[model samples]
Structures are given as structure tokens and as C-alpha cells.
Target: MLQRKFDEVVKKEFPNAKDAKDTSIHYLGKMQIEHQLDISKVLMATSVCSDDINVPSTTFFNVLFGPFVMGGLGGVPFVGQTGMTAFAHHIPDNGSAFIFYGPHIGITLEGDLGKMYRPRMEETGNSCGALMLALSRLQDNDYTPVINDDDYQQMKLEESLLPYRDEILGSDNQAKAITEATYKIIDKKIHEYIKTCKNEFHVDKVTLLGGVIINTDYGLDDYFDARNFEVIDLKGL
Candidate 1:
């Protein structure tokens, strides 16, 4: 049933596409060069930790070769670049410093959180990294995001009984509360990053990219307001 629903969503979103593989290939080929360069800058910001630390050589490699890899196989090179950039950007140039990159949320530098949160392709449950999990649990399965199998599912028996308050809540008020709470956590983390890392690193702007920006009904604009951040949609480029 989930597969059928997903297929229907894809068909509705890309009606002229021949199949999934074809859609992926065509979509990958549409990535503009200017957009790739903009993404490279965000990848670069992830590396800014201290004065002594220099940009890693791998950063350059990813920026240059990322498109080629994506052409051969569909994946975002910037996602993996986040970790390497954080490692190079640390103040002491030591291995201890870390950062968190939530695909749907945004980047959270070290010190923003008590500990590092590993990036997961799917949100497992109602934990610190469960924004996607809550969205997955929404009762109206038709309102699904453009995510993969493990992350997007029809609500369970209990989840379907959830009461809706408005469009933002869908038919699952619990899911709405969870999703809003998760965004609050992420918003707080970003402010903390601004307080500690922004000036030290000479950071000025933030950019958000991914399927979540387009697929999800939630808007991240207000969360980033007055923070010098902009959301970019490569598909519209």
C-alpha cells in the first residue's frame, strides 16, 4: 500500500516521466552549474571551525567531482561533505569537535547541542532526530514528503486515531506537535551556532537545500528570519 501510494505521488508530481530511474536521471542532469557552486559555498562553511584550520583538500575534490558522481549515480555529494568540512573547521584542529547536519532541518554546530547526532536517512522515532519520524507518522498518508521507503509510511493503527486541529496538523495532532517541537529544537540550535561560531568563523549567510524544502508543507523562512539565511530550491533553478 505504501509503495502504491508513493507511486501515485510520483506520478502526480511528474506525470510525463517514463519511470523512476528515468525521472532520477533527468532530474540529476538538470542541476545547474551555478547551483552547484552555491552548494559548494555551503559545503565550505561547514569547514570553518577556527583561525588555524585550513580547508581540506577533499572539499575541493567534492566540489569538482560531485556532479560527475551524481551523474553516474543519484546522490547529494554535499551531504557527505558536511562531516569532512566540520572536521577541518574545528578550532584546535583536533578530532574531538563535531557538528550535526539534519537533511530536513539544517546545520547545528558543536556546542549547540550536548552531543553529536548522527545523520540518518530515515527518522526512527520520537527522539532528538525524529522530525522526519513525526512527519512519517502523520495520518494523512497522501501528504507525504519526497522521501524514501524507510522514512515515509502510512500511520499505524494508533496514529490514525489522532485528532486534527488544522491543515498544519493534518489528521494527527501528535505528529504536528512533535514536528513543531523538533523545529524549535533546530531553531534553538541555529541561534546557538550564531552566538558562538558565527563571529569566530566570519560567517555571514546560511542556505537551505533539499527535497524537504519543496516536499513538506512546513515553511522554514520564519525560523531563519533576521538571521541572514536563504533557502534555495535547485529544482526551480
Candidate 2:
């Protein structure tokens, strides 16, 4: 498992962190943990960097998932770079962190979250890094941000997919219906990812952060069954 792999690595690098009961990760890293894990509630936050062009244009929506559930910034400086760096230094080394990169689903989501989160990308100047700092603060054991097999399955449920309510519905040609084709493609990939992890972990809830996630056009809370998964809009807080 990714967490196990990470925990092993952390044990070697920061031995002192093992004692800390809590830690935090910044920038969401490369892994994640499902809400079903036996852990305490950790604070999740995201921001819209004043500058955003540095982020690749292909995987914006995927990026939102990392920060929202784990915690971090988008692409700005103080909000993203400096903040993430500082946050990482403070975490006791036992907690977890999650960071999202824009290129993962940039081409897939069609830049919807990117344009919506910071409509005036030209004006923001790409300084979104608060969440990144938060992720960096985590200790490998204290926090686990990787997304495993179980987490992927829970994310597929109509309710789990609700966080992306806007992308599923919109005003442009891309925004119409959750077509069978699109769902099929997403479902295939999701199922494939789930086959490798522990069965106990599941994406019961999703936390959203970053400028792109916050500025999204669809109000997931409005249409989706909030009872299933709570969407934590982590833009300002």
C-alpha cells in the first residue's frame, strides 16, 4: 500500500517524527488516504494563487481533489510555494499531506475549474500556496494522503462524484449531461485503481480546496445528496 510504503520511508528519514501523534503534509504529495481510515479529523484548506499559469493546463480537476481532502494551495507564491514550504517544516512528521497538480486532469476536465476558480487568472498572478505548505508539514506516519483502491470506488458513487457537480453540468458544450461515454471512461479508470488497495478504506466524504475547486461553476451541494458526502469548500478557510 502507498501509506505503508510511505510510512516505511518516513521511519528511516525522520525518526524523531514517529513520536508525534499528529503531522501534516503539504502540496498533497503523491498519495492519499480515504475518509474511512482510523484517524482524527485533520484541517483541510485550499487557495487561489494570484499566479496560475505555471500549472499545466491538462489536469485541473484532479488537482482539486488533493488539496480539498488533504490540504494545500493551488499555484500561487505565499499562498502556495512559500506557504507549503513553511508548513512542511512545522508538521511533526506523523501527519499526512495532499497536493494536486493541474496537469493530471487538465485535458480531461477541459479547464473548467481553472477558469471558474480564478476567472481573472491574469489578475491573480499565481500565488496560491497555503495548502501546499500544510501538506509539507505532515510526517509520513502522522499523515497519509495517497488515494488507494478503496478510495477510488467510493469516489464513483453518484454521490461521491457530486463534488464535481459543476463539471457534470454547465452552460457550455462541455456542460450538458454525464454522458454514458464519459462515465464509462471514468468508471474504468476508477475501478482499475481500486483493485490494489485495502478493502476497508473508502471515499465516504471528499474535501475540496484550491482556487479552481472553489470557483467551479456547479454547486454540488445544491443538487447532490449532501447526506452521503459533505463537500468542504476550502477556498478561504
Candidate 3:
């Protein structure tokens, strides 16, 4: 019933879109999810790696919470609410609930997406282009027409980036540079969060599930471990 409702919603919103055929994994999880999908909780980690800019909820949720989990995790307040409300229309009141946030987990789902969706590498430079490529591959798919091809070009111009070249993005140094920048952002946010944390909620075992959890460097894993919070690399699963 939930699946049927989701299909109806998706079809209503994107009339031209095709329902991705149900496969082994979907089948396996279908029945359980219809009832109690073991995992009771979920957290979405979106990217704030780049400077603050607006992004659509669908894009963010796909990057943050694709690959169906036990419960609904990533969605915006408005869209997610509507979608989940539609979902709850079928679900029992005793079933699991859902939630969403604005880059609460610092997952960096846009790792390569921001740069890769460009039509011309000449327009945005290779770093951004490569990032898009990385995002596609990370999501196990390629660019579709829905993505804005021109966004990267405009972003490049805003950043005053140099000419486009594949070399800049395909290098170990480039990856490291991106990683470092992301870490700085994460560090600041986490530090701020830790400082403000004065209660049990701060110390509770908070599980992180997003792109940023993939990083073993920056001691993110260690930091969470030390705090006794479970830093789950859900992306790996």
C-alpha cells in the first residue's frame, strides 16, 4: 500500500517519469517495510560543503537518502511532509515515522555533483565537472535532463575559477583539497554543536548516515567514537 501510494505520488508529480522496476532488494525489503522495517531511526547528511546556496528538496534527498532504508529519512519540511503524509495515509499509526533537516549531518552528497552537471567543461572548469561525474558514479547512474547543466558554469564564474581542464579534477591533490575544505566546514559545525551541547541529547549515540561518514580521515570516525556516538557509514551498506 505504501509502495502503491508512493507510485501514485511520483506519477502524479512526474507524469512522464517511469517507475523504476522493482528488483531483488526492493522485493526483499517490501514486506518488512510494509510492516516494521527493523531500523526505527534515520538521519540524512546533506552537503553544505560549498558556500550556502539553495537546492531543491528532491535533489538533496536523492543525494542524501536514496536506496530505500527501514524508514523515511531525508525530505524537506514542506515536500517531505506532504510526501510522508501521503505515506502515512496508508501506514498504521503504530508504524515508524520520518523526519528531515537542512544539512544536519554534514554528509556532502554534492561531492562531485555541483561540478559535473555542466554541458561544457570549458564553461565551469574540470573540478566542478569532475565533481558532477563523481556524483553520478556515486549514485550509480548518469546525468538526466532534470539536472541543471548551466548551474555549474554560473557557480564557476561566481567562484572566479580558472579555465576548465580535466586534469585539475582527476588528481589526488584535488580530491585531498576538496576533502580538506569539507573537513573545515564539518569541524566548525561539529565544534559549534559540541560546545552548545549541555544535555544528554548531545552525548547520546547519534548515528551518522551520509556521504561525509565515508571519510575515515579528519578523525570523524574517531571523534564520534570518542563521544560514544555511533558514526554509521550507511553509504557503504
Candidate 4:
């Protein structure tokens, strides 16, 4: 039902996105143009890893929450209601900095909300889809695994593999390793972009949107308050 609703929404709003592979970018580009949002105030990340795409969402939930829940952790709390979790929980209980670590990652620095960023090497392929591909190789004894929306979602929600939860959710797991590595690269980029926003662009507050924010790892409390960033759900706008 959720998938159907998302499809319908995409179909209606993105009629011109016929050849566009990443629907999130298409919709977000449209939204940015429609609302005249300031690109300097927004930073976006996604698994699409395409520099051509603009600040982006439904694909957000699939990538962010699908792994944890399908790994048998169960659905995230309040996710269905607000479509975003706060960034507080992702931090260590005593930690200060918020580190985002999700698979199939992509980072984009948008300077103008009305325009799209050109493809850059640093902004693409910072993801764990390779790991997923490897896992698929082991499972199917095939050399290549085609990573797509349906396969990724099914892999996350597969119940027969529950016994392998340790492998999927372990502290030293491949998923964690991929997320950490990707985060390290993207974190520096984000800080650099944030610095530019503050120093050059004179932008103070950051606005985070997209389905990736819905994961339980994110929280809305003191963490963001300390950083002075705001969460803006596109659904509300």
C-alpha cells in the first residue's frame, strides 16, 4: 500500500521525469523550483550518488529504515507519523557529534536551490551498495548483483535470514564498516559545506528534509539544538 501510494504520488507530480532514474531528485528539483527555496540553506544526501540530482525523499525511507527493520529490529517508532526521527539517538549515549551512517550513500552540496550541481567525483559512490552486491554474490553464487529498489527492499525485509542477524547487525559488520567509511568522507564534505554556508553565504540555520531523516537513528532534541540545524519535512511544505 505504501509503495503504491508513493508510486502514484511520483507519477502525478513527476510526469516529465520519464527517463529520470532517481525519482527523489526529480521531485526535489521540482519542489525547489516551485517553492523558491534557498539552496544555500539545504544540504542533501542519498543513495542515488548522482551529482546531477538536486536536493531530495520515499526512496529515503527504503534506504534509511529498511535495513534496520528488515534486519529484525522492527519498525522505527513514530516514523509513520512524522516521517523523520531525531538525530540524537544516532549519537552515542555520551557522544556530542552526530554521525550519520547508512548504506548506498551519496552526498550533494547545493549552492542554488533553483539549479542542480554538476557531477563531482567526491559526491558519488560513497555507499555500501558494493557490500550488498557482495552479499548477493555469496547468496546466489553469481559474480554480479544488480542493486535496485525492489531487491534492496526485499533483502532488508526478508525473514528467512533472521538467523544471520548477527552478521547483519554486528558491531564489526560490513554494513557498519561501509556506513562508517562513507560517513567519514561525507562528514568532512558536510562540515566544509556548512562552513561555506556560514562564512560565505551568511546562512545560519540548516534545513534537513527527505526520508533518510525518518530513521530511528535521528532525533529532534538537544543535538540539533546544539548544532542549530532545523528539520523540515517536505510533506509539511
Candidate 5:
């Protein structure tokens, strides 16, 4: 009953979202059937946020090979092209690659958009702590992110969000809006890196599952709103 209430709140923002575990099963089945991929041989890489909460969000973590983590804060593929090259090189012999990438938002039972209870916590805190921080910083009209080595990832995250500042700030739901914008940015970067490092992959097919991860309260199931699923023919690229 409590879980249902939270689902209502999450679905209000992401109507198409499904349980995270179910999503993993669905995609795994699709990869096996439609894409003809071998479940055991496929290597998995993740480009989601660095948040530990997201680690257990889906079964992909348990079922696949090295999650050659490619994302940093806000789910940006911060590891860049070199990382992509490494991930590609690490694919199982004659096996395909699967990349699961996205940004996550926490939805509370009371209908809040960006806060939830983490494991062992009694209070709701920012799920995408990096993203919420970015949103808070973005609220300041004159604040500009300066690129520096000390906080390069956060700076780059805010820098990537600059163009979407107006769109996100002006939205009816800023949390959801920023999350959506971040998804677009992450998706675009993933493709760019893949295209840039396409040759590094010896595999013939690369399956992609990109989306927004909706985090629920601790011990409850999370959800994934899939936005893109494709099996790229690397041979043609």
C-alpha cells in the first residue's frame, strides 16, 4: 500500500516507467530474442550516476560482465572516449556489448519529485545529489560554473546544463525537467563517444538501453523509464 502511493507520485512524472528489475528482464529478453545476443557472453557497461543507490536498482548488475563504469556525476560519460575504448576492448571474445545508461531522480511517498529515503535513513535526501546541487546552483540567475581541476566533474556537469538553464528553470517541475535534460545530454554523449570509438569494438553488435532511473524509498523497488533501446550494427559503422 505504501509502495503504491509512491508509484502514483512517480508515474505522475514518468507514466511509462516500469519496475527496474522487470525492465532488466524485458531488455535481457529482447537482447536474446530480437537481437539474438547470448546472455552469458554479453559484456555490460554502465553510464549512470556515481550514486551507490543506483547500483542495486536493477538485476543487470548481477547478470552481466564488468560494468566498465563510464559515467560520473549526473550520468555524464565522464570517462570519455578513452574509457569507451577500454570498455570496447574488454568485451567477451566474439560477444556483444550492452550499455545501460541514464540519470536517476527520487520520488517520495508524499509526492515530492527529487527526494527519497536512502538505505538506513529516516529522512528524504537528494537521490541524484549531484543533480539536485546543480539545480540549486542553476536557480541563481547569475551563477556561472568555472571549469577547474579540483571539481572538474561538477563544473563540467553544470557547464553541460548551461544551455538548458532557461528551459529547466522555466518548467513547471524543475526537478523532472532537469532530469529530462540530463538524459538528453547523457544520451547524446554516449552516442558521440560510441561513434568516436566505434572502431575499438571488435564485436558486431552493441546493444544500448538508455533511460531515466526513478528511485523510490529504501527497500522498495525502483523504476526505469526507458527512452532508447537499440542494437547498433557496428560492422556498418
Candidate 6:
């Protein structure tokens, strides 16, 4: 009953979202069948948020080689070009590469777009704490993030969203809006990094899967709204 409510609530914001676990099955099957990627040899890398709550979103962790985590907050690939190059180097011998990139937003059973119940928790909290924090700060038009080693990643995450301030704030759902902007940023950067580090990869092709993760309450399956899925031939690049 609780899970059903969550489904309805999440669908209100993302009508096309599918179960996150189902998403993994669909993509993994596509990689093996249509693309001829060897499932045993494929090394997976995730450019999603560092939130612990997101770990259960997909079965990639159980199936893939390495989710060489590239993202920090709001799905920003904090490791940048160097990380991509390193990730390319980590692929299995003669195996292809799979990179998953996206941002996540939480929705409650009662229909709140940015809040959810964590594991064993009684109250709702920000799933993408980094993003929600950025949203709180972004509310102040005069605010600017200060770069420092201690909070560099968080600051950088906030700085990245500045350009989308108006688009996020002006939306009917600020949290969902910010998450969407984050998806665009993450998608752009992932492609750029892949292009810059193409030569580093010995693999013939790289599969890119980018999407938005819809987080729900604990014990309930999350959802994924796939925005892009493409295989890039390194030889052409």
C-alpha cells in the first residue's frame, strides 16, 4: 500500500519513469544482445551522487565489475578528465565500458517531491542532501559558493547550478527542476570527459547510459527515467 502511493506520487513528476531495477535489466540486456558486449568483462562506472540511499537503485553493483564512482553531488563527475582516463584504464581486458551518469531526486508517499524516508527512519530527509543544500543556498540570489579544500566538492556542486538558478527557482517544483538541470550538467560533462579521454580507452566502444533516479522510501524500489543511451565508437572519435 505504501509503495503504491509512492509510485503514484513519483509518476506525477515523471510519468515515464520505470523501476530502477528493471532499468538495469533493460540496459544490461541491450548491451549484451544488440551491442554484443560481454557482460562478464564489462566494467561499469557510475556518475551519480555519493548518497548511500542511491546504492540500492540498480543491480549494477551486483553484476558489474567496478562502479568506479566518478560523481560527488548532484551527479557531477568530480574526478573530471583524469578520472575518466583512469576509469578507461580499469576496463577488463578486451571488455567494453559502461558509464552511468545522472542526478537523483526524492519523492515521498504523500507527494512531496524532494523528501523521503531513509532506512529505518521515521521522518523525511533530503535524498540528494548536496542538491537540497544547494537549493537552500540557491534561494539566496546574492549567495555565492566559496571554493576551499574542506568543502570544495559541495561548493563546486552549488557553483555548477548557478546558471540554472532561474530555471530551477521558477518551476512549479523547485527540487525536480534543480534535479533536471543537474542531469543536463552531468550528461554534458560525461560526454566531454569521454571525448577528451577517448584515446585512454582501449575498448572498441563505450556505452553511455544517462538518466534521472527517482528515490522513494526505504524498502521500496526506486525509479529511473532514462534520458539517453548510446554507444560511442572510440575509433571515430
Which one wins on lDDT? Answer: 5
For residues 131-237, could you state the per-residue lDDT of candidate 2 as single tens digits?
A: 22222322122433444565432223333224444554442422212222233333333223223221222332223222122222221110110111223222322
* Candidate 5 worst ten-residue window by lDDT: 2-11
lDDT of 1 by residue, 86-130 (tens): 423542321121122211222122112111223343432222233
Off by over 4 Å in 2: 1-74, 79-81, 100-237
Which segments of model 3 are wrong by more than 4 Å? 1-40, 43-47, 50-175, 198-203, 209-229, 232-237
Model 6 bad stretches (over 4 Å): none
TM-score of each: 0.29, 0.22, 0.27, 0.26, 0.98, 0.97
* Candidate 1 residue pairs in clash (backbone atoms < 3 Å): 47-89, 49-89
Q: What is candidate 1's CA lDDT for residue 109?
A: 24
The residue pairs that clash in candidate 6, if any, are none
Per-residue lDDT of model 5, residues 1-237, tens digit only: 977887788788889999999999999999999778998999999999999999999999899997899999999999999999999999999899999999999998877888988889877899789999999999999899999999999999999999999999999999999999999999999999889899999989999999999999888999999999999998777
Model 5 / residue 214 / CA error / Å: 0.5
Q: Candidate 3 versus the native: TM-score?
A: 0.27
Estimate, for each residue in 57-176, the C-alpha lDDT of model 4 and write its tens digit: 233333222221101111111121111222222322321221122223222222111111124433233222333333443344323334466655334323223334345445444443
Root-mean-square deviation per candidate: 16.1, 20.4, 16.6, 17.6, 0.8, 0.9
**Model 4 pairs in collision:** 84-214, 85-218, 86-218, 86-219, 86-220, 87-218, 87-219, 88-219
lDDT of model 5 at position 10: 78
Q: Which residues of candidate 4, in runs, are more than 4 Å off?
A: 1-48, 51-172, 202-204, 209-237
Model 6 residue 105 distance off true place after TM-score fit, in angstroms? 0.8
Residues 135-221, candidate 3, lDDT per residue (tens digit)? 333333232323345654233322221222233345554443343333333334432332233121311222322212111111111
RMSD of 6: 0.9
